[model samples]
Target: MRTRALLTPLVLAAVTTAGLTVAAPPALAAGPDISVTNTKAHLDQLQSIANANGGNRSTGRPGYKASVDWVKAKLDAAGYTTTVQSFSTSSGTSYNLVADLPGGDASSVVMFGAHLDSVSVGPGINDNGSGSAGILETALAYAASGQTPRNHVRFGFWGAEELGLLGSKYYVGQLTTAQRSAIRSYQNFDMIASPNVGYFVYDDNAVGNGVRDDFTAYYDSKGLPWEYIDVQGRSDRAAFRSSGMATGGIFSGAETIKTSAQASKWGGVAGKAFDACYHRACDTNTNLDLVALDRNVDTIGYMVWRYAAKDYGTTTPPTGSNLLANPGFESGAVSWTGTSGPITSGAGRPAHSGTWKLWLGGNGASATESEQQTVTIPSTAATAQLSFWGRFDTAETGSTVYDTLKVQVVVAGVTTTLATYGNVGADTTWVQRSFDLSAYRGKSVTVKLVATEDSSAQTSFVIDDTALTTT
Candidate 1:
């Protein structure tokens, strides 16, 4: 959670007005609302913990350890193997707790965290007690659901946040390079129930685009007004984002006063601070707005449930550069694989460069067509890349992913889809796309571009001037 000094409002525009390109996803069954009363009860317990120890669950303090133990005991009973990571801080020793749910692909993890320790002021309930309780309940609910996940689920409760994001930074710093890469997304929640609340979503990095879209879609479904928060170095997300993982999360306003316009939109007091008790002693359970708390918790639960099963392809998107023969189809089917029909010029869809671009799936029928080439990267090569100019003109509309062009890589007979471009963004001009293929060095693999069309609308993926090169 943020202290007043660190609460800088980077960008406060509504989600719809934030100039984000939201990819349409199918409606998510957000599941039933997980006991808001129970969530609130957790807030009360944290409050009591603070009241008993020192009126604050500050890092290196007895209340903080007690808080961690209380939460760990609950998770242990729920069948989670938890880890408590200890690190040194100005306060002497601080800790971070991580609990990984059993089952699911550990290779790709979906993580969420909230700062558990609070300022040494009052009981710090709304400052972060709200976020901690919400995430705790979500974790418990997922454990009890009996639903096996596709992606691994992990939850974290960090110590020493008010002392400048120390615990989260330590947790992230301890991860190995491969472990860092394995985290596909990280969601951080802090100050979620400010008395005067305004909904906010994290937005940064193109990699976070898909996750950002999911949050906005959830809010839109609930008729909730959400804005984008830059987050920068304000919270735990900055730690993971700096380590090269895509991150997204929810935040209610803190420290900043609610403007008349914001108050008009979200129904809060116009001229008052979002959390009049940001890091002060008055930040107790009474500092919360249950209505906003309920909505944000449900949204977090919705994302956790959906992403646990999200398919991130069989392998990381193939990354490298110029190893394929007839890379652009300029020489037709002589050095490539797939339907020869896509190599021709006159069947429609202008080429990105030469007249021989690969044109797939303009048949307006339920069909699939592809173009691929086998390439080998030397083990000694330090860098490789795959680049191409392409565009899709689609007859389909809305966010429904009707027609798609799957960019895939095949290694050891396993095809991993690097990306799936859908029918939403149609264009009259070509766009350039590239991926790092260096990860496939020392192996020969088939890099394929496949397009599939629905029975109704026609979508054409026109490709030209492709190159996979090593340097």
Candidate 2:
């Protein structure tokens, strides 16, 4: 039912890349710090598009197609290869805008997507404009960065999601087994900037849990709290998951009231629905929570970089000789400096392979933490490889502010960034990340993991099974 007028509308509102160059083995680059202001600009454009084509961007409507065109144009201008996939919907012919960033592993693709259509009632800015605009802005950021990732990143602005996931289902149906298997992970964002927001993470599956953990880590680092909301079959993710694809995402909330406990933790009024305008004509630009929108958009970039930026080898590493001491934190931060305090170790949380893991930030904990250990290389070794399993969650409040995780190589007095991870969105599952240390083979070097949390909205960062070996 259209409920805009029946609920209170919160006052909060408002809220990329390219390049050439083949550099040294890609050091883990920081995901672009997304701009809330730029996100607001996209919302304004969507609002304008809706205002001109009819009062709504609904399926089979002029506004819906126009929204697709506008998004496609931006992607094209930014150098993303774009395509419009047509599908038949009850309302009529609808289109989905699919944009691909070239130069990643085609066999293993990572998708960041959102539904682009609104219900027929209003502008639907909050119900979906929040998500569509957020994903669109993140895509543009990727183009601007020009960083070649390890997995192909695909962006989908789906149509008819409001009409029962018609567009997404169609798109998924068109994929062959090979195509489906190529999708390593799919992340969806819907209604992320709800007015009276609650930070909710989608807990769909094991992979979804990893995604949830990433967001959990981010909120933890920022000193924010979150709750798990099972949204199976609730959004476009339903379609992808139904097709056997791994998926995860974030939602600010909708219609669900903020409990007193939630209010105490998140600092919002109790008894108020996260969004007062769910599927109503008043879900306009003014109906959003700027803070929520900004953080989620930044998270989209983080997840893209962490998951899409690397190739998860098809097989797990064989357990053998590992050189780093206290590799899994099972013995607690021993052999590492600056890590004896603040670091957490224990059971309960899922681990990559052991009963313990090192947590850089705990749930709802905030601080800048680091752990370093100097490892002496055997003069006889001509090359070395560094490997570790890590998972994280970082939040971006704006273009210049966000949590971060960096793995560094220090020799003498100089520090070289080996890799970085942040805005993990929801990565909770353990994934292995490796680096070649052949460059420092002959010298004693300090291998360090540093985590930095912003002043607000922090999450967690975890690592396990560290190893350095000559191969």
Alpha-carbon lDDT, every model: 0.80, 0.74
Error of 1 at 212 (Å): 1.4
Quick one: best TM-score, which candidate?
A: 1
For model 1, how does the per-residue alpha-carbon lDDT over 263-382 read when each residue is reduced to its tens digit? 887898999989998889999889999999998889878888988988886652334435555566654443444553677768467777777788888888999998666555667777
Over 213-294, each residue of candidate 2 has an lDDT whose tens digit, in order, gives: 7765665555455677776555788777877788888888888777777777677789988787888888999999999888
Q: What is the alpha-carbon lDDT for the whole of candidate 1?
A: 0.80
Model 2 misses residue 309 by how many Å?
1.6
Instruction: Supply the TM-score for candidate 1.
Output: 0.65
TM-score of every candidate? 0.65, 0.61
Return the top candidate by lDDT: 1
Mark the regions of model 2 whose C-alpha exceeds 4 Å error after superposition.
1-31, 206-208, 314-471
| lDDT of residue 179 for candidate 2 | 65
